[model samples]
Target: MLLKAKYKKNIFFFFKSLLISMQNFLKQFKPKKYKAYNKYVIVSAVYNVEKYLDDFFKSIINQRLDFKSNIYLICVDDGSTDNSANIIKKYQKKYPKNITYLYKENGGQASSRNLGLKYLKENDLNIFWVTFTDPDDFLDRDYFYEVDSFLKKQNNIAMVATNIIFY
Candidate 1:
């Protein structure tokens, strides 16, 4: 019993230390205020989304943010099992370094977003703004700029949203 208790304590301490180390590693990557551009948008794309791929990518590529201030667009290909990957590939070719990709196994939408978030967190990308865009929807150019600009200028705001229509 005495030996077992000591072993258990050692195990507990080991795990505790491991957890702290992981936290520290993540913290190191935490985003700092960009002297030039401190904001980012995490746009995600995944499998079986050919229907909405073109409009979606186009919308992002055409964002009107102050390009002088970098808007890091972190995009992902979540193990798409369709021409979805091909379409995303096209975007990759067209945009070059504009889009960042995190290709993962065949996980669902939530997984895709989670993977994207992991990349964001690991890279310490200070994203003062993020908005979800449905792969199957069309967006106006002003969507993100309006949200980001409005949020940036406001000193006392909590939440912002738009009308949603689901057929």
Candidate 2:
């Protein structure tokens, strides 16, 4: 009986040491964790809205948040006959890092938005949130800043809506 008890204690210690060493060995092969920047992607289905395109782009560009790093704008043009595409191209040239311009045959707003989502998935951007906007709709200067603040506080939320002020 004494011999059996001693052997059991030795086996227990042996397994414990083995488990610790295995854990340490596994840690080395673990995936290296790099700091991730949570970015917000805004998708806008743009049709022929040449008149309002400047205002829309200005509102987005003038947001208080760091436009270059914090926010990304995906503008999906739905075959605009007007000079809307030209305006988008202009802005794209000016802010190439912050804006992504996609041209697709006219299929309505929903399809354009879906294409924007597909682009997001294909690129695999580190996105924390996604929201849709209209080409004619302009945002307040502090819009993205406020949204970012609220999002940081309420990470559990899936959706957020802002009061729209029709001018």
Candidate 3:
């Protein structure tokens, strides 16, 4: 009985040490930042915009493009105390491949945008163009498609801005 108990204790300690080492090893691949593998990445920062998320997300999801895979959306939530996070999560679930969500402590919009840019830089996304929008804003259905077409045709253009129609 004494020998059995001693062997059991030894085995338990060995497994505990193994588990700790394994956890540390796995932390290396925990994704320091998200990878953007698309041609155009749209980064939007949100804070407690649950009321407007639906419209914002609808505009994004309804974008018309011949090559739909070229566009990506990155939404960063800056410590929203409302249901904004949940709304973003719902959209993420619906468009897992197109949308990337980042959650951070309450910093202002600039900080959130910086985090998005950091993610793109750290992950080496190599995207051709980037854009930003407010969570309460609307995007036209041909937004990405038009932008892609225009950029492809213009060689000297560094950036493009569209006219906004406010309600």
lDDT-sorted candidate list, best first: 2, 3, 1
On lDDT, the candidate that comes out on top is 2
Clashes of each: 1, 0, 0
Tell me the lDDT of model 3 at 82.
98
* Cα misplacement distance, residue 40 of candidate 1 (Å): 2.9
Per-residue CA lDDT of model 2 for 19-93, tens digit only, reads 999999999885432221356888999999999999998887777676776778999999999999899999999
TM-scores of all predicted structures: 0.65, 0.75, 0.73
lDDT of 3 by residue, 49-160 (tens): 9999999988876666532466678899999999998999898888787788999999899999999999988988788688989899988877777777777677888788
Cα TM-score of candidate 1: 0.65
Residue 48 error for model 2, in Å?
0.5
Question: Between which residue pairs do clashes occur in model 3?
Answer: none
Which has the better lDDT: candidate 1, or candidate 2?
Answer: 2
lDDT score, candidate 1: 0.66
Candidate 3 matches the true fold with a TM-score of: 0.73
Candidate 2 overall lDDT versus native: 0.84
Clashes of 3: 0
Q: Of models 1 and 2, which has the larger TM-score?
A: 2
